[model samples]
Target: MARLPEPLTPLIQRTSIRQVGRILSNTQLSPFSMEMRISWNAPQTLPVPGQFFTILPCRYPLTLLRRPFAYSAVTESWFAFIYDIVGPATRDMAKLKAEDDADWIGPLGRGFPLPSPDVKPILVAGGAGVGPVFFLSNVLAGRGSAHLVVIGAREAKRLIRLEWPSHAEVRLCAEDGGTGITGTVIDGIGQQDMADKVFYSCGPAPMMAAVHRLAAECGCPSWVSVEEMMACGVGACQGCAVAAAGNGGPQEYKRICDEGPVFASGDLIW
Candidate 1:
């Protein structure tokens, strides 16, 4: 497994073994994406930004595997998940209504490390990856941290929008010239320097790899949230493992559901 940074150890230790969240609302963000807000009836452990949950819609018996979703936002009343309707499980999730019950297990895995008070934060998101990135922006803003959010999509119609906190400045990037910068997120970055910023990103692997390259070019440190498929959204299944750079030992694999969905940019073998 890639070596998760020492700072993440404490967060990993604080995760709950399991919990339940009740669905309060499920709204469509785009044709293929839906935003779900779930509330816990009794007090339960809540996830920090970058942490995720494994949810099984009670009605979808056909899909035994729970779906993983990063917490998109959290409030006193509920926490949210924004997911793409890519398959049977998620398509059924779109039919979920307010007050519906779903089996929720989590607040699991490691989250992004807290940033130093003096450093500026740069959040990058690609497509559905915006969920956790949005949550992180809110957390940083609440901490009085100044940050920039760069969001990307395939085209203008594919973009997702949200009310960003006042402390964050939002920039948009599009692969096609229909909106925002007419290029990939990295291309939209142009010649600006990021040497003083701390970077965090979640998205398709290729997009994140590009962000890592950008971080390297400006000599900045970065953290990334990885997405993997899992049968059990816990370490027991070992189904969501990824290769990591060998650190004075043989190559290893880490479970995305447990050790992380988040890791230092330098730690990954990719």
Candidate 2:
């Protein structure tokens, strides 16, 4: 069951517009994350890297349901979301302030696919999923491609500081060893070199099911970015169902807000 690869499909067909976005800076990166920074008015397309976006607060309306996130760092006009305040609609979206006004929608769902240039792309992030694996390791270092990011946190002020990706090759786990390579992220994917590498995970859910069981025991080929809990980011509220691997009948369910918050870790059911 390892023949997945073919889900990138989004050259255009993006029409989601609730629109408003204007905040522009909210700060506080770790110790429970939060990076807000919106402004984007360019929306006919623009959100790649495990796409997602939902926001809805407009002067603190607590929670009616729009919260989704992901897509940390984009710039045609502006975009950035690194959330993790946890409750009360992300603590009222960190009390938004720089010019306030929020009520978005997005380049929603399905993203993170681009890995067949002869393997080697790793990624992995955890907790606030380090903003779409630092926006997919800066789009795999702007396509020059040398990748391998890792990230993970649980100490060291709960990491997530951002501004990495100078050509990727980061790695900073910290399950309390205080920083860089101490534990978790499966001990930084067990010190890398997973043969022809391909993984591309994103935060919790047992750390993306232990990086898809160590990328299927190193036979490598993985992808995930699911994070659930949505009332309706789209897909009309099937309520973010997950769990679907092969035959269970009727495709057994799949819609982390519309067919994926990026999938293909052997197509779910972990």
Candidate 3:
């Protein structure tokens, strides 16, 4: 794990900023989709992937709400994220043009670990889960490990925005049968050999639960990031707790904020 920077440490709890830069999507989806990237005037690199940064509304909007999104990708020059603009916070992001800014705080929670070279990797995602998977995919590809990526959506149009690896084999699934593969992305995994692969997954609770089952069936290891309603992104407020197995096979609670947004397969309970 990388050490947290001192400057970013304080801002981890602050929200709202003077607004900074805006990023535009090169193309729109059937309805509309745009990639939004914002930069903080704060003096540092945004936190690592799997962690998130929040964008607080400035006085002009008066919505006064903050929207949190993951650290999708980063370079020395900039950090990026993908947005579908389905709601207010993202809708605000679509409105800003270049040169405006949004305050950023992160690299929060632990990121998914890559599979060791001796094992193949399988990446699965649904909806916005695509954002973080893209970040993970690029990193693994650079190191020369091949990843089989499966993305799922309700229908062809609802499929999430993604920037995929140049060398990876990509598969998409639409429940209504209109994209790369028909049915669930889970179907994509069934068609392949899981004998020597490890899995990484994210998305809806039911979806993650299902992937957890599949990984166990194949005798493969798996990890996942949980998405829960949150107030404070850190441990202080205690908003995001996951169910874990307690001492008598009874239920226990684990904080997603302090402990993880990411967890090993055995760490979670249905």
Which numbered prediction scores highest in TM-score against the true structure?
1
- The Cα error of candidate 2 at residue 96, in Å, is 9.2
Decreasing TM-score order of the candidates: 1, 3, 2
Q: Write the per-residue lDDT of candidate 2 for residues 90-144, one digit (tens) a residue.
A: 8777877899988888877778877765667778887888888888788778878
Cα-based lDDT at residue 207, candidate 3: 80
Write the number of the candidate with greater lDDT, choosing between 2 and 3.
Answer: 2
- All candidates' TM-scores? 0.92, 0.35, 0.83
Runs in model 1 deviating more than 4 A are 1-9, 17-20, 41-45
Cα error of candidate 2 at position 78, Å = 24
Global Cα lDDT for candidate 1: 0.82
In candidate 2, position 201 carries an lDDT of: 86
Candidate 2 C-alpha error for residue 189, in Å: 2.4
lDDT of 1 at 201: 96
Angstrom error of the Cα, residue 143, model 2: value is 26
- Which residue runs does candidate 2 get wrong by more than 4 Å? 1-7, 19-31, 34-49, 54-56, 60-68, 71-92, 95-102, 108-110, 114-123, 130-151, 154-172, 175-187, 199-270
Candidate 1 vs candidate 2, lDDT winner: 1
Worst 10 residues of 2 by lDDT: 4-13
RMSD to native, candidate 1: 3.1
